[model samples]
Target chain A: MPKDSALPSRNGAASPGKEPRTARGRETLRRLLDAAAAEFGERGFHEASISGITRRAGTALGSFYTYFDSKDSIFSALVTHMSQSVAAAAAAAVAPGSTGVRREREALAGFLAFARQHKELYRIIDEAEFADPDAYRAHYMGTAKRIAARFDESVAAGTMSPGDNEVRAWAAMGMNVFLGLRFGVWGEEREPDDVAAEAERLLRDGLGPRG
Target chain B: MPKDSALPSRNGAASPGKEPRTARGRETLRRLLDAAAAEFGERGFHEASISGITRRAGTALGSFYTYFDSKDSIFSALVTHMSQSVAAAAAAAVAPGSTGVRREREALAGFLAFARQHKELYRIIDEAEFADPDAYRAHYMGTAKRIAARFDESVAAGTMSPGDNEVRAWAAMGMNVFLGLRFGVWGEEREPDDVAAEAERLLRDGLGPRG
Candidate 1:
C-alpha cells in the first residue's frame, strides 16, 4: 500500500479542516526537511543534489518525491520554517505581558542566542537570498515590514520619534546585520553576546544622542 | 611568438622605479585591471573564470598569466585595486587637508557616490574579504580608528561630547552601511543620493543624544 503524504495530497478524501493522520508520515517529513537543511547548509542550494539529500535522510528517491515536487520546494519549506522560528523568538522577546527595558534586553539576547545556535542555516539563507534578486526582495522586505510595524508602535508612544520609522528600523536592525555579517556569517572569533550588548547600547542612546 | 604582455619586460629600461616603458603596455595593464573589476563584479571571485576575464579584456589568457601567476593572483590584484579605490574615496571623504562637520558631510557623500557607481565591485570585494577573514581587517579597523580620532577631536574641543567616540564613529559609518544595504543592495527603489542625505541627517541629528 502507498503511504499518505502529509502535505495535502493532490487528491484527498478529507476537507481542509482535516489533519495529517499518521505519526510516521509526520516523522518522515521532519527527517526529510532536517536532511535537506543539512545538505543545503553543507553544499549551497545550487551545488546540493537530490541523491545527496535522500542519502543523508536514508530514504529512497521515490519516497522523497512523495512529499515534495522539487528541490525548490525543499528550499521554500526551509525558509518558511526558519522565518517562523525567528518570528517566534522575536514574539517571545516582547509582549504587553512584560516590562519595557527588560523586554528589549530579552529580545536582543534571544536573537543573538538563536544566531549562535544556527550558524549554518544563517549562512545558507543569506547566500540563497542574495544569489537571486527576487528572493532577496521578498525575504528581506517582508521581514523589514514586520519589524517596522513594531518600530511604529514605539513611535506611537514617546519611545521613538516619528521621523521615518522605516529608516530608523533599518538603522537599528542594520547594526545587527553587520554584527551577523562579521561574527555569524564570517565565523569571526568574537563574543556575540558582547557585540549584542554593545549594539543594544548603540540603539538605546544612538551614537551620541543623549550625551 | 610570445608577443607582448601587461607587465614590463626584463629587457625594458627604467629610471629607478617606474611603470611600463611603452605607453601601450601601461594602457593594457589598466584595461586588464578594469576588466577584472567588471568581470569579478558580475560573478563573484570563486564563480568567475580567468578565461572569461581575458575575453572581457579583449586579450589573451597568456596576457593575464604574464601579469599575475594564476586565478588567485588575479583575485589578489583585483582586491588590491578595489581596496585602493575604496580607501581613496574614504580619504577624500575625510581629507587630511580639512576638518569640521562640512568635511564629514563631503566625506560621506563621496563614499556613497562611489558605492552607487560601483555596486558590483563593492559586492565582490565585500564577499571576497568575508571569505578570507583577515583580508581587510587592518584596512577597516584603521578607517574606523581615523573616524574615531575625528570624533575625539570634536569632543575634546567641546564641539561634541565625552561619551565614547568609538561608539559614535561606528554608529556614523553604520548608517552608511545600512543605507547602502537598504537603498542599493536589496534593490530597493529609491534615489541613493537622497537616501544618503537623509542618512546624514540621522547621523548628525536623529540619534543626537536628545534629552
Candidate 2:
C-alpha cells in the first residue's frame, strides 16, 4: 500500500462544506489542528471549546468558522489528523530492505518517539472513542489494516510464516499501543530502542513451542 | 504469588468515609455498580446522572449515598469494580496446572467473553483514562504486575524462556486487550477460542526466528 493511503483524509475542514482552497488556507488549517491538539489534550472534549482552539492557534474566531462548523467536527478532524500523524511517523522511520521484524520494531520505536513528543496523542485518540465513536473506530481499524499490509509484504517475501495476518496485525497494534502508553506516555525510565528491541525479540521468537 | 494478591483492592465504597457493613449492604453496592455500568455505558460520564443510576439500579437515592458520596466517587468506585471484575474473570478461567501459554490463552478467552458480556467494559475503562487518571493507571499497572507474576511462574517451571518479563507482560496484556476489543466488543463474527488460538500461537512462537 502507498504511504499516503495509510494516512486518513485531510479534507477535515468542515467535511462537506469547507475544504481549504488555497495553500495559505491549508497552513491556517494546520495551525488550527495543532491548537486543537493542545486544547483537547488539556481540557478534554466536554470542556474543550472552539474559541479555546482558535485562541491557542492565534487565529481570529472568523478563521475558525471558515473551517469547522462546530467543536465536534473539529474534534473529529483532529482525531483523523493525529491518526495520520502516527502513521506518517512510523512510515518515515522504516527504510527499504528491512526485514519484517525490523520493520515492526522500527514502527514501534517511531511510535514511542511520537508518543513521547506528543504526549497528548493517547489522550486525544482515546477520547475519540467517546467524543467521536466513528472516528475512533476508523483510527484503530486503519492502523490494524496498515499493520496487516506490512504482514502481507513480509509473508510474500518469505520472511514471515504465512498464517492469519489479521490476528497478528491486531496483536502487534495492541502491543505497540500499550507499550507506548507504559514507556512512552507514562515515563522515560526505559529507552524506546531498548523497549522496542525486547518486543522485537518476542515478535521474532515467541516464548516457545517447546514442551 | 497467592491468587488474592493478583486481585487489586476493593475499598471502593466511599474512599474516606464508609464501608458496607453487611451482606445486604454489599449486595446493594454491587447493584449500584451494575447500574452505574449501564448508565455510564449508555450515557457516558457527562450525560449520566445520579438519578439515572439509581433508577437503573432499582435502589433508593439514599442507597447510592450510603456507598458513594457523589457521582465522581461512584464513577471511581465503578472503575475499580470493573478492574476487579476483569481480574476475577481471568483468574476464574485459568486452571491450576495450565502452562504459561495456556494460562495466557485462557486469560484472553476469559477477557473476550467478559467484554462480549459487558460491552461497556471498553467504554468504562477508556473513559476512566480521562475521568479518573489514577484509577486508569492503577488498572493497567495492576494487570501488568499480574501478568509479570505469571511470567515468573512460567520461568520457574521451565515452560518458557527467561527474558524481560515486564516488557513481555505488557506486550501480552496489550495483545489480549486489542484482540478483546476487536473480537469481543466490535463483532461476533469470530469465536473466542479461534481468536485466542491465533493469539496463543503468536505468544508461543513468534513470526520467525528462522528463515
In candidate 2, what are the lDDT values of residues B64-116, reduced to their tens digit? 88888899989998898889899999988888799778889998899999999
Best by DockQ: 2
Interface DockQ of candidate 2: 0.71
Q: Lowest lDDT 10-mer window, candidate 2 chain A?
A: A1-10
Evaluated on the second chain alone, the candidates' TM-scores are 0.74, 0.92
Query: After TM-score superposition, what is the CA distance of residue A201 in candidate 1 from its true location, in Å?
Result: 3.1
Candidate 2 CAPRI classification by DockQ: medium
Candidate 1 Cα errors over 4 Å, as ranges = A1-23, A95-106, A183-194, A209-211, B1-26, B43-47, B95-106, B126-174, B185-193, B204-211
Query: How well is each residue in A1-211 modelled by candidate 2, as lDDT tens digits?
Result: 3333332355554555787766677788889999999999999999999899999999999999898888998998889888988999998888878868889999899999999999999999999999899999999999999999999999888888777999899999999999999999999999999999999989988886454
TM-score of each: 0.75, 0.94
Instruction: Name model 2 segments beyond 4 Å from true.
Output: A1-14, A209-211, B1-15, B209-211
TM-score of chain A of each: 0.77, 0.93
Question: Which candidate ranks first by lDDT, i.e. highest?
Answer: 2
**Model 2 lDDT on a 0 to 1 scale:** 0.88
